[model samples]
Target: MTDFSVLAQTAKAWPFELARALEKRVAEQVKAGERTAEAPVIFETGYGPSGLPHIGTFGEVVRTTMVRHAFEVLTAGKYATRLICVSDDMDGMRKVPDTVPNPKSLEQYLQMPLTVVPDPFGTHTSYGAHMNSRLCAFLDQFGFKYEFLSATDCYKSGRFDAMLRRAAEKYQAIMDVMLPTLGEERRATYSPFLPISPSTGRVLYVPMKHVDAAKGEVTFTDEDGRDVTLPVTGGAVKMQWKPDFGMRWAALGVDFEMFGKDHQANAPVYSKIARILGHRPPEQYVYELFLDEKGEKISKTKGNGISVEQWLAYAPDESLALYQFQKPRVAKKLHFDVIPKAVDEYLTFLEKFPKEEPAAQIENPVWHIHSGAPPAADVPVSFALLMNLVAVANPTDTSQLWGFIQRYAPGTTPATHPLLDELAGYAMRYYRDFVLPAKTYRAPTEHERGAMAELSARLKTFDDAPTSDNLQTLTFSVGTDHGFENLRDWFKALYEVLLGQSQGPRFGSFAALYGQSETAALIDEALARG
Candidate 1:
């Protein structure tokens, strides 16, 4: 098997189950003498243009993409694959966004079929097109390679007519299912695909036929889990919904589709509609909802949600991709703190994995880290040290850091490499603690300058030794010269010279690691400046 195939098979535990089910379905169809081996298989996802697409929206694309990738690996180029991102742009404006400059009085018609939403930006012909275009660009930028299709364009084509006629003929069986599913259904039937207008905060009234048709006959109310219907000026099949689903399937030639769990009923509705349209219904599944960091379900109206733009602001796109690949059935709770950690973790994974043949990808974290701890073979140093290194990094040059790594880490590295950069970052914390906290011995007085001169001269003998013990020896020598005066005071002055501060970490030890020549030169410069 190819690398991609092996990695993919290991990653997908349920592939055999899915493959078996698919084979059985195909065999049954073949036995009926109705199936073909050359038919195109599609992975389709319809996006809503109501607002900026969120991470959850991207999750669908990622999962569907994985499925496509899996099948391609299985077929080894025998089956042609395509992932279609259908933008339901023709949908009407149901809720106005606060970002738009001026939202007209389009609410009454907003929740109607997506084909009717008005473009509030006045940028596109309709709201559906406007939202669809943005979503297409977003999906493309997200590394999803898919063809974009629009509902309005689909309706313009005659692809839906056959499906519609079939639905019209099988309309009674659909009603049989709908009446039982809805319970207490009365005078008229309903289609699951009709755009529902959530006017009056909840009621989904049937939209009037044509702006000129004058009056809508169907009135629907949710009673005890049933869609109770009553007589109105314009009710009947005109108020049904399958027409839209049937039309969409043919227009796009979609093979598989998935929706959120909230629409569990809609799938069956679409399936029956597909049968009525004389076409195969797209294979379907439901996605669970996402939660906040604290583990509560996300709601668009509640405004307690994280946007994709906010996530990408801090995360590399690949980390976001990993989160998407994480189990579709599992709900993830995420927060801001995850950003820095994700960056660190991603780098670690790359370091360990190092190679990617389509089949050998690291699809799960457990394979790397077992029982809450990473494998014992690859240990890492402290994050604090890395952060310190990064903070103190000089953009114009990095020879000094490279020299230190050669002395200590023993490897080729980037100047701004994550670990190195973090190590240098220590200087920032040092400044806050010492440079900003001095109250006495602020600068070297004349006598102190003489003492500093004497100390610097004596330190020349040990210029090559920056180790802690050597620094301690030099400190003892300097301590003997200031018997009556505060020996600590002179030491602070020395620190001011070396690190531009009155006090810092134990001077001798710090001077050693920072290098004897570098420390000596800094002391003289700070003395000259003040």
Candidate 2:
């Protein structure tokens, strides 16, 4: 294995940091003799098909791969492990997907296990397999060693049978952890890989008790203790969630698994299940969810998401990597508007941290990007701020916007920021192609107009040297004059008056940070527009 324990990343992400922690813990396990030297370090990920994989989805795997690479360097071949990707395609259809045509007919069978759904693509052996295989393809491109296990595969291999028996054997303990997490009404079973897919109009489940995929049937005692064979495609994996974590550990020997914060009970529940299974639980890293531009959780299952595929169309894969590199541990909404600024922030960071490993350098210096010492690790620029700056710069005409772009983002000249060239491309594309054109918010109400007139009168009185506090006061006062809510509201009005658009970026900070003259001129333009 490489020297994973102490590997250095100039721009460290959560996974890199987590990798270090995981190594120390594994060493502790080995020293305590709890794990043999030869035991594999299993990195696992579970997937459900609500829609196309998003950047967050790839973030999990890429980060894990980084950790796995480090672990390999450390073990030097003494330890072997693989990232096991469990596609819970057999899970029930939670919602009708936009990607699929007319899933309404599939709705009646919505709660059925995934095994029953006919492959919409009609290519893979089953619908579940088809959904999972897409992910497998993406991972394959990344060249990570992964085992794509469907629920069907696990049951067919009798892997789940052992877990089911254990769940029955450890029934009380399962509920002890389960009830507290899922609530008193929910059932506690021990399967994580179960899924529900749709087939025909009827719902089918892969019975939780005993599923046999080989014969396409499940064995269960029909309450009367009579052994019955149910169609495998109808029912789905029956285990409750908490016990499923334990089953994963006991059956798969999983070493580490990360999840999003939505699964709040996962940690405690997994712990309880671990005790019941007589196996150590996997290391856990819980992450926050990604939101859309409006701050709603990005979900393709609900026909909402700025998907990874969509993101790739605009952002370079590595830029996307850099986006996830900062694990803020809080929910963030991402959208196309983010790109125009993200490009500059990333370029600035790379400029600041120019020293990086050979792997990071391009064959050509002109095109090369190296890590900033801290890689500007955080290029703290806000979209609102940049947009405001742009507003001040003369974007009224295409030529003026280009001129303004040249001044601040000099790379547009090719002599300065070659990266800016790309940013300009993306920015121009976004404005021209993506941003929906609409009328500005209704003309400021009379009270708002009066407040703006007041602010104009006040500012009209002084030509004082600008300061931060003064600028702050100006933004707020201007809003008051306009009868607007606050400085932000004033700025919005200013944008309409200048560019004939709603919502101009930050004005006061831009004026303070850059200068008063540029901001003043921008304001003049806005007053003209209104």
Instruction: Report RMSD (Å) for each prediction in the order shown.
Output: 11.3, 8.8
lDDT, candidate 2, at 473: 78
Candidate 1 residue-wise lDDT, 1-530, digit = tens: 34443454445433323433443454455577655656556678877777777776787787666555545554545556678876655454557777765665565554554445566778886666677778877888866778887655554454343444444455456556566665444324344324233332222533222221122223344424444433221112222444456446654566666677777767777776566556667666576777877788887666665677766654455556555545556777666545445555655665555354433343444232221122322213223223223223332344554554444344545543554444333333332343335423346777767766666666666655366567766876676665526677666666555444444555565555445665566557657766
Report the alpha-carbon TM-score of model 1 versus the true structure: 0.61
In Å, residue 252's CA in model 2 sits off its true spot by 1.6
Name the 10 consecutive residues with the lowest summed lDDT in model 2: 363-372
Q: What are the TM-scores, per candidate, against the unseen true structure?
A: 0.61, 0.63
Return the TM-score for candidate 2, rounded to 2 decimals. 0.63
Worst 10 residues of 1 by lDDT: 230-239
After best superposition, candidate 1 residue 230: deviation in angstroms?
Answer: 21
Question: Model 2: per-residue lDDT, tens digit, 36-107?
Answer: 777788898877754555566687776566556555544445577888887665455666665665666656
C-alpha lDDT score of every prediction, in listed order: 0.53, 0.57
